[model samples]
Target: MKYIVTALICFIILVLISSCRNDFGFTSSTGSLKFSQDTIYLDTVFSTIGSSTRTFKVYNRSNDDIVIPRVALAQGTNSKYRISVDGVPGQVFENVELLAKDSMFVFVETTVDIMDFTGDTEFLYEDTIEFDSGANLQKVALVTLIKDAVFLFPERDAEGIEETILLGTEEDGVRISGFFLDDNELIFTNEKPYVIYGFAGVPPNKTLAINPGARIHFHSQSGIIVARDGTLKVNGALSTTEELENEVIFEGDRLEPLYDDVAGQWAAIWLTAGSINHEINYATIKNASVGIIMDSFNNASNGATLKINNSKVFNSSNTALLGTTASIEATNSIFHNSGQSAVVARLGGDYNFNNCTISNYWNGSFRQDPTLLISNAIPNTEFTADLTAANFTNCIIYGDRNLELALLDDGTSTFNFKFENSLLRFNDSSNSFDGIPAYDFSNINLYNQCILNVDPLFEEVAAFKLRIDNTGGANGIGDPASVTATDISGTTRSTSTVSGEGPDAGSFESSDLSGS
Candidate 1:
């Protein structure tokens, strides 16, 4: 009897150990808690004068169905804090379970007392709500903080009026919402900087120029359209390391792709003719329609001179830089992983680059014009550039053809196209011009000085990105010679040396050109 009792005790201990081992950070299909965002950033905090609201996303990264028990304010006050459980009332616990890979959100409302609270928090505030088992609880904090200076517009009231905010009320340090005015003119002086959505809508008769370090957000369909006399000048800055590589969620995309990820849902700063000059410097425009577009429908042919320097356009749709009849001078910039062509020009447009790097792998079709098998597609149907009129010199152009570039049957030609002392390459079968041969280029010019094999050595093309390594001048070209950003595109660019004789062949120079 004693031996049997001892055996029974041993068996029980073994069972208990097994159960404990199963409950690791890993959850079973039968447990609770779900989360999509591994982390969330309030970015900053608001003051006591008013408040701000940001979404705290929840996702069920697990395959099980979990429930939320109770949602409460954990050490946070009512004025500065409030969270809704899936937009529900009364803290109902039954409905918060997130399905596998499904999405739900928690709304965090913050009110800042402008006259009262004045402080900042470098770290995000954190708390927890009671969650039932099986609920894959993944939560990120949503915070709103006060700033040193905020753009407050004119408040509406019956009695008095000192000033009106240029960007209206709803956009007070929050999201972007506005009308798509195509025929209106907008002017922003020193004191009155127009609060804008994205840089996609350069409406008719409107010209917009942003001051240095002027903050703008492209949250929704915020972009620009340059109507007659409409122009846009954006002067942005080099995002800090913590802020430079960002992650965002698109409508039809996954949770948040990396900074270089391209969903190709690009919007553009579309420029029409007779617009004012656009000068953009030291900025970052990511995940827009198109990085910058010069519409080709204008008859005046004077699309506008776009000066770009020390900029970066990442993960956009086809054609990072699209121009028509516009003189573009871009230097010390970078363009990579475009869904289509990195740069596209039409209607006698000019593309001049120096010490820039550009790369793409979108068959160069979407890079320019990707459509059905229409006989009159832009590149294949009719392509012409007035070389004496069009200028693409002292730069690098690369695509997925390896070092050998692929040419569309109806693509632009090198007519009076002066490529002096530049390197050009493609990734075709021959690795030369013959490997990718299906075009009519009777009008062209070339000055391939020290250009290695006349091909663009793209280390990673399938990924729609490029790394120009001007090591041996064999595969990729780095900026070695001094390149000027203001030369071709007339952009006020930063000075930096490129690696290859082909030099940095795209829109960006990776040499820390800011010298900071």
Candidate 2:
């Protein structure tokens, strides 16, 4: 009796498996398919480069299972756009099935050459994705903007080896790949956009000047390196309108809007040891491993110099402004949204920030470092140097973390730092950080009339709008004499409707608070 019962159960399981596999009663779709969107805008794409993959859903709302007789691009195989229906990628598909009340996704991407079009430098590329043929057909539009750009990359030799220069070797004997920029590439103009691949090194004694309205895009792992004795000058003027017409912008080559806030898309602007006389104004640098690295080889006696004004650097995987034994003076600048600290002064440095905003609201991962970190000693190393001067005046140093400022001294070097009339975010909830000597908020010499642990009430964090409202603690409490006359947006800082009636701390003076 037991053997008979077990055989019967096996037969029932087989029948259930066969029933599940037999989905043969599918009816032809009668143009009743619904889509997630009627059109998909692929954003801007550089010539000869592919676009980011975009997906949309096709829903089968009917009760009966449906079979799409045909699904294809309107231009067929000749179309520059590519589509993948269900799990199959091709110009067309036949007999695609969708269960009742189910949905399937269609992925689309494109790579078009600008030369294929007419005389225009930028043109619109458009096509349609067809769901079915004839009277029962449904269509979805596809659009992309293609722009012509100047591409700079290393050439390959006869032996198949690409051109490369030496960026110092590692302790493990591995050398970093780089290439020097050509003489003709010294001056980047606004006539066209520039795209760089690999590390482009500036030759010694030469200067790379970028003019106003210039857009520089870097491919993955690519960046610019200023060699010893080299200089980089970004001469961008304030824009007359909101379009930032005169600002020099540096970002990754991915033109998709989805990558706008993504960090670490490329490398950094490396001002190597001995590089000097660097200046950046009215610039925007974003989405890099490290936005800018100012290194003087840890030689306190020979520090690199960078005078930056009216600039913004953010979305860095590492620190936005990384200074190692360098001298940096910044005015009306903004640094925010970094994976680690927004600003890091390590191994000692001479740094000064006036009317700047250093806020790190990094949600990409668990951030272990503070928004502003200053240390005279390298971690787990014997290297130590003197902190000549680290000063912050009329600035906002705040973040999502409890302690946005950290000062570490090995006690072997001069840790000279001061903050005046600024707003800081330091909340030692557990009294863990209050015990440290650097947390002595009552010290008049180091902390002078600085607001602590108050919400700045930013307009929007994700949109990079650091402007504060009337309720912001940074409003009208800044020392007018120490800050810039005009804010980052060219707004005058002296006038305010807020009660305190002074310049507002940070790179921005809120128009809502400052009645201007």
Model 2 agreement with the true structure over 207-279: per-residue lDDT tens digits: 9999999999999999999988898999998998887899999999998878999999999999988888899
What is every candidate's alpha-carbon RMSD to the true fold?
11.8, 4.7
Q: What is the lDDT of residue 68 in candidate 1?
A: 47
Error of 2 at 204 (Å): 1.1
Q: In candidate 2, residue 185 scores what lDDT?
A: 92
TM-score of each: 0.55, 0.88
Highest TM-score: give the candidate number: 2
User: lDDT by residue for model 1 over 1-516, one digit each (tens)?
Assistant: 999999999999998887887323333334334454444444443232233445656555665554444345544344355667677733334434455567677765544454454343222444444344334433344444344323322233677643221332475643232344433334323231223334334555566655554443333444555656666776555544544322111121111233235445435666656565777777666666677776543333454377777776666655577776556767656665566556655545455666555655554233443210111124544555443333334455544444323323334343333443344553235424543323213224434432533544444555533443333232224333444544222333333444332334444322321222
Show model 1 residue runs off by greater than 4 Å.
1-71, 74-206, 236-266, 297-304, 361-390, 403-414, 430-444, 450-482, 485-516
Q: Roughly what TM-score does model 1 have, to 2 decimal places? A: 0.55
lDDT scores in order: 0.47, 0.89
